[model samples]
Target: MNAPNIRPDIRFVWLNVHGGTFHKLIRLHERLRDSGLSCEVLFSVGPPRGLKLGVDVPLERVPELAARGVHFLGRTEVLNRAEKSPARLTVTDAHHDPDLPRLVRGLRARGHITAQMATLLGDFCHHGAEHLLMQHPLTLFFEMDYNHTPEGRGFAQAKTIQFTGNIFFEPTANRLVNDYPDREAFCARYGFDPARPLCLWLPNSCDARSETYGQVIEAVRGAGANLVVKLHPWEYAFKKHGGEHPWGLAATTDVLWSVQAVDETDGTWAYRFCDVAMVRGSATILELPFLEKPCVMLPLKEHVALFRAQANLVRTCCAALSDMRDLPPLLKNGPPAYSPQDYEAGRKSVRIDTTRDAYEQTMDALRQILSAPEELPVFGSLAPLRRMADPFVDASLIRTLTPSRRLRYLAARALRGICG
Candidate 1:
């Protein structure tokens, strides 16, 4: 269905073109309405370019948001007629889109404020960082904390950065207070044994091998623990077969009997019930530390070096397993004892800002930008650098690279490093 007409007085437009982006944007929208903001806030959904790929709002979630009283807009409608439907500010998650720089330029020329919100922890080392660098000179860049600030990373666009705490924190905390189930209730809902230790497995989207999943299952069973496998959204949307298990797990009967697989977009509620978490170098692991849940790193061979380089703090603060066989022993032994001081230090490493509420800080930053949008200056030189480096990080191109093309990718990356 087509989005309804966008009112002229809308002050905030949130453009979401991916499920993950919508997840964050929706929570922020709810908070904005609850804060009693007088201005109009519209949630705009963009068309997905590929099949089950770039969809902004998942079909199932449309009614959910509508029930919450969020006004809707098709992004094309707003952008195509930018002058007629002017919003004081537009917000999007920090993601790579080839057309983003052009869109930002067009919107700014038409007197609209553009901002990107940080959705992931440790975004500097994630793909979003490369994307953020491409969209420099934004009216505002709402960073999660000090670790994500542009100046801390020596980026040229420091002036555009604002240190807001983790966007997921406040929403998740509220849910825990009001909606979370007790341990017994949670176990009963999922058919987990209340006595056995519960292990939550959050795997990366790229490595969904049946053999690896089988190994994890065996290790969990051997350790006498119950397993809950939370599939990443990509895995659920694209990787699953027409069966109860995702494509990789259909053949394993253990998945049917022993594992509980979940595909929900928001799985934070499960964190409180699980005793431990096992991950394959996903950013989701960063959230576990804040909850005081210990994690076991099960990095794949291809990602070991990258994981160590970017997530060393996670490896140090939590348990790291070099071999799958070691998982059984680690689970059986229970999570390593971490003092409050240890958890506090881990929180600092991820740059969690505790001084104010994240949603409030985000609203304050938006107000500041709307009041004085021209104060944020653009660095002309960095634009060319972004253009030059973008292709090296393009997700589609990287996925289809041949051996010869990979050499070129490496060469381009080296050149970008030297040039920067």
Candidate 2:
């Protein structure tokens, strides 16, 4: 695809590997422009084959971004143009992009600054090949908070890591407060009872057959609260591809009360209206405290083990359900109250900088990097040398594989002592 005609002296090239990252980048770009940073910005979306299910940025949004003086490009086109383009910096979210490490290295080699910003808390959790990117000496890493895990601390002390605030917080909060000012009107539009406590359930993409999902719905009903469910975008994509419906039997069958299933666009608004939230492996766990809403974590056994550090931190501050039966009483009694004091405490624990909003912090970081000497110095040691032979597999590859193929892949990796 031909690149859109814009200023050739692009100061920032933002690459988005996921739809969520794309939207967050848009927010940051808007802020930078509004703040009178006249530097040209180019937005690039990952190719369809490169992205996982449900994370592709919709093409309809491209024209709108273009109308705002942002040039949009395909992943391949951006990579090709980067070789000779006069862009001063290239920025991307710390998503599971298999090409990130190599791309960062290439850009840095060409005397351009490279940055990877964390859009979610999970971004701090380095797993498998991500360590390669995190440990790179030249690339700058921006995180939502001061990571508490051992791995996170090690990377922070070794690499060029900066503590930026949550990029989604201000935008989401402002939208909820300004766009949907009245909770009653918002509830009425959705046909939800404003009288009952509203519980928003944000499920992971792979939670199609989860038994806990049904239990949560029943628990909300038992507590006499209205339920709003927003499935991961991937779940909707899966359903379109003849996969199991996210609601399973509930999708076809009728229930006693309303189960309003909303799209991704309604997520932030729902967070504002809901009294409490039910989450499993969603970033909403970290975000809810900032909104002053307590969340109930319904962690699957595998997820807890995989994300042990995050699980421990969340379970420490929020209410986590070990037994499904306990959900009703907690919902009825209302989960532990999360106050401004609690938010401050949690902020300190995570080491998030709240003196200014995320957008301003990000802009400041960019200015600092841009004004730095062109000859950037290496900061970290030669640790990336040890993981040279690590089998670099895209996480999406594993997610898209058939059961048999997945088992075979795991077996192959196990033979090489890479699979845990």
Candidate 3:
């Protein structure tokens, strides 16, 4: 069934593309609903597939998500570029959401984009629309990080509220931060161990970013490490014998097809196993030190302020990188403020109330935005998506796994003769 219409009095929640970032939004939605407020969500079917993209309906499970009285809107279907767009292999456009212009215009008129979606939302507070941002700490990422905040306003369009990293990405607690390998373990796992240091290259798999692949690939091949190009798991799927669509790579620098992926390509895990992790982001960079690895970053220029605003714990943890190459000239600018002392405190630390606190923060910000007569957010709200959500891992393999009854995680520790 089509999602219900947005109530006239409801606040409009604008989000960019939807994928892993939804982790926090999902949590907040449930909380907001219980409190009796409603919101609207905007997304495209598969990561902005439009010549210009608009909104998309999520999978059954996503809509079924208990977003606290939230209603999804702007659902439209476009070509699945991963398969349908033959022209997609070369030059492509991430601006397919043709409705985006309309969406932006509508949001601005509604007054939500002024604060929550667009950092500009702050400029529109008098209109009464509220934006809820689902932020992650991918220091270099665009869709879901600080680039949408006050600092990035000079360049990045303000359509979403800015939140911190951990909230968007949930990291595994330390299993003893192991050495991020630079050898063939990543290669051997995927069958390409020609024996160069393993250099893991993670790309922004969005179609909007296809134009930069050449630049990225050049950096990957030029870097002295073995090139293990791990495509974001969001858009593409790896295939072996014509199976396993939407999968990615191992630590090795080969594009070998696979029937299964460990969901392990996540930079947090790769940071522990790879020699030098190449990212266009701070998400992995922020978490790299726990594994004691260095990073090669792509300079996007929008993450600086967020770095300053992040909790000191996030800053302290990342300064340990072996080297910070990639944008040498830009080094004069410096990274966000993350203190090393705060690292130990945030790492492997779990706050059961973190989720609800984040939710209340977001809602409170929305309310503040509604009540404010000013344009910019006079005060930053809680970093809703920065806290890691609850996760269940398979004890036997130590791989992060979703909760389940069939695989039996609840009692498996006992089954293995280990006490929980």
Scored by lDDT, the top model is 2
- Could you arrange the candidates by lDDT from highest to lowest? 2, 1, 3
For model 3, how many clashes? 58
The residue ranges of model 1 lying beyond 4 angstroms of the native Cα positions read 1-24, 34-84, 98-102, 122-159, 169-180, 239-259, 373-375, 379-420
- Number of the top TM-score candidate: 2
Give the clashing pairs for model 2.
none
- lDDT of each candidate versus the true structure: 0.53, 0.54, 0.36
On TM-score, the stronger of 2 and 3 is 2
lDDT of 3 by residue, 1-420 (tens): 244333422333332433223334445444555566554433333222211111122244444532433333333422121112121011111122344344434445533333333221111111222333433222212322222333322222332333422333344321211223543444455554545555556654321234344544454445433455555533332221123333233432223331122232233444445555555533444445444444445444333333222322233443332223543322223333445545444443322233344456556655554454545542232222221111212122122222353244335434444421
- Give per-residue CA lDDT, model 1, range 52-144, as digits (tens): 322334566555555564545665654544445555565544544454445656666766666666655444321111113111111121121
lDDT of 2 by residue, 1-420 (tens): 355444332244445433333455567777777777655555564333223222343456446556775555766666666555645666654555555556666766666666656656445432211112221111222121112233333342223445466566543533311256688877877788899998988866434556766788888889998888866644443433434554453342112223557544456678778888887777666666566677777756554543333444444457777777788888888867766776665554343465666777778766666576655444353233212212323343244344675676466546556523
